[model samples]
Target: MLNTSRRLWNQFFRKARKVNNEPLNKVSLIVLIVVDIFILINVVMGLDDISRWYISPSQAEPCYSQWQNYRTKTTTDKDFEIIKNSFFGIDNPLSQEQIYQQVEERHLGKVSQTCFQYAKYQEQINIPPNQQIIQNIEQKQIQVSQFEQSNSNIRAQYDSTLLEKIAGQSREKSINVVGAEKAKQELDQNNQRISTLKQEITNLKNQLVTKPESMNFLGFLQEDSNFNQVEVNYQQASFWYPSIQLGFQSLFLVPLILVALSIHNFAQRREYGLIALISWHLLVIFFLPLILKIFEFLQVGVLFRFTFDILSTLLGGLLFLISYVYILLIPIVGFGIIQLCQKVILNTKAQAVRRIQDSRCIQCAKKIRTHDTYCPHCGYYQYIECPNCHNLTYKYLSHCHQCGAFQESSHNHA
Candidate 1:
């Protein structure tokens, strides 16, 4: 086993240092290395782009996230703040009732539209009639949005005018009467306009909500059967998204790896040294991204999630122990792989058979003369005594060349 490991190490070192009989000068080697880097970068970029072809969990069920949040939590001041920041674009205080109404109206319209789109995607509903209803609601919402924006501008202008009037009164100890009255009138007109716009916006939202078609769509979305199924689909999609990405990336890369490997092998056989070298580089470059993607999948894929959930359930407060568990587990898994390679893949007798057949030194894999009793390159014994035939035979071989008898103890000498 030790001799086998040494020979394998030497073989890998030679392969890594140079491709078959192809002498690459430093400059050309650097150029090839640069080409490899560029190809690897593009492959990774292509993989990332292909991974996005599938709809993400968030995109697949946007309505579910919003609905889940709405159902799970009571309306809080933070919710009001989010609405104020997003819609009003201001930090000015507003009555809680107004904020709550706006919040409810916004969520209802958003949830209805998202659910309708989702239903269409799922092919659960007729698209034409529902599309028309969605368009109508969208148009009304747009109008309301326009009105609210205008109202915000007017309100800002009124506040500025009011502040100016107050400043004038404070500085002079007496107001500029004409300017003050003009500002006052402007403020009142601004206030009235703001009120009118708010009322119009409210009416538009109310009409959208009360419209029979809109109400029916919302009702359908609210049904336990429809909503529950959507939730289930979303959860499943979320759970499987990483696996789907990994599978797609694998599909994209496997073909490239196979093609490169085939070309490399063919080139090597034909002694097309340059083609073999380039194909070898391509094969390595292709594998780079596949390895990285696999690591990423292991970190974020379904297996990780399943494992984490199990740990969370089983350990709870002791979950931090998982870090230690992984630290130990990885080395054990690595040791098992090493043992597999040593015992099965790089078995001493198996390697010796191939080396002997190739007329190469069993200890170093270098060419040897047929009549040589010992390897010239490594100065190792070339033959061993066969117990069955009592004749000289190649060392580390499972059979004796003289009698064609099995040499089960052949590896014991090595």
Candidate 2:
């Protein structure tokens, strides 16, 4: 097995290093290596592009900003508290349906308002007015921020004074429930005042919206059937972008690798396992593309869409079945392929042809004289004594040339 492997390796190198009878120059080999390197780099770049698309934080920035602007008009502190609790609190956390409902009630209204505002502004909004409106919004935000800072400081001082009074009562061994109740009332009043301030801030922010921009185009698209179809197409592309990129990358990369390997190993097909080589190449070239296309088909949600509709409504479930089927079928198919290579595909005909070219080295396919017992090019033993005529004959050939008699040896059959 080791000797066979070594011989195969030698054959591979011999083909890689030469074309016809001439050795490939160092420059040509270097060029081939560089091309392979470039292919590797291209694959890496494709991966980067896919990752960038998937994790694009900026894609929703405009939507988020518009959502925030809308929230100033619609959302209150109570709504904010509910959202924060749903996210972090351990007790009575929101169910998926409840969370979605809350989001729809609060945010969907804003989304609608935003779209309506955009439609209204589209007719009248100009560059100068838009700039002035944006400036006004920024100034209102600054004022709200200053007020919030001042409110925070006042709240902190009131809380500290209440804590100190409670500690003092504890030290005196006389629990002042009246004093404690008054302190609680003051805290409540302070909270009410802060809430009033926040409401006033929201009103100021709402006044600054002189013009509105179209940000939720995706959401706005759902209102019309034509626009809804466009949304579906966009969603499909967005969903499949990564998988399609991967498939495309593999589509090019795998072929390049196959070509490189073909140049290095199958240059002299007749001299090697020609049948096995050809069959393997066909399998690789066929199956790899098919697999990639299957992945692309899956990623685009086409099965969820209408192409698979005629076949079955539950295409997604069918795909899961197909995935398991592939898992089982692949090994069986692989075993069959291995058997084909070992038994039927890699037959002795190729070796017989090589033996017919008996004047050449069996290992390297370099020309040799009939009298030479071993190949000068590859050091492969090429000649042996014929038992019938006691004369030198080709070792790999079936019939002895000296007497035209059959060579009864296991090596000859092989």
Task: TM-score each candidate.
Answer: 0.62, 0.44
Q: For model 1, how does the per-residue alpha-carbon lDDT over 1-414 read when each residue is reduced to its tens digit?
A: 576567667655444446543457898889888898899889988898778766666555555764565446554332322222222212436532344434445331222344555344323222344434444545655665665675555555656556766666463443333344555565566567656655664554455445464455445545566568668878888799899889989989999999998897577546566777788778878887887787677677886788778888989999888777667755675578679867795577786777777777776556788879888765789888988879999877768899999988787776
| Shift of residue 188 alpha carbon in model 1, Å | 3.8
In model 1, what lDDT does residue 41 have?
84
**Candidate 1 segments whose C-alpha is farther than 4 A from its true place:** 1-13, 19-23, 49-185, 252-276, 341-349, 361-368, 371-414
Screening candidate 2 with a backbone cut-off below 3 angstroms (N, C-alpha, C), the clashing residue pairs are none
- Please provide, for model 2 over 51-142, each residue's C-alpha lDDT reduced to its tens digit, 9 standing for 90 to 100: 44332221312133333333444444433222222222224355333443454454312222332333333323323444454455446556
Candidate 2 — which residues are off by over 4 angstroms? 1-128, 131-135, 138-157, 166-222, 235-359, 370-373, 381-414
In terms of TM-score, the best-performing candidate is 1
Residue clash pairs of candidate 1: none
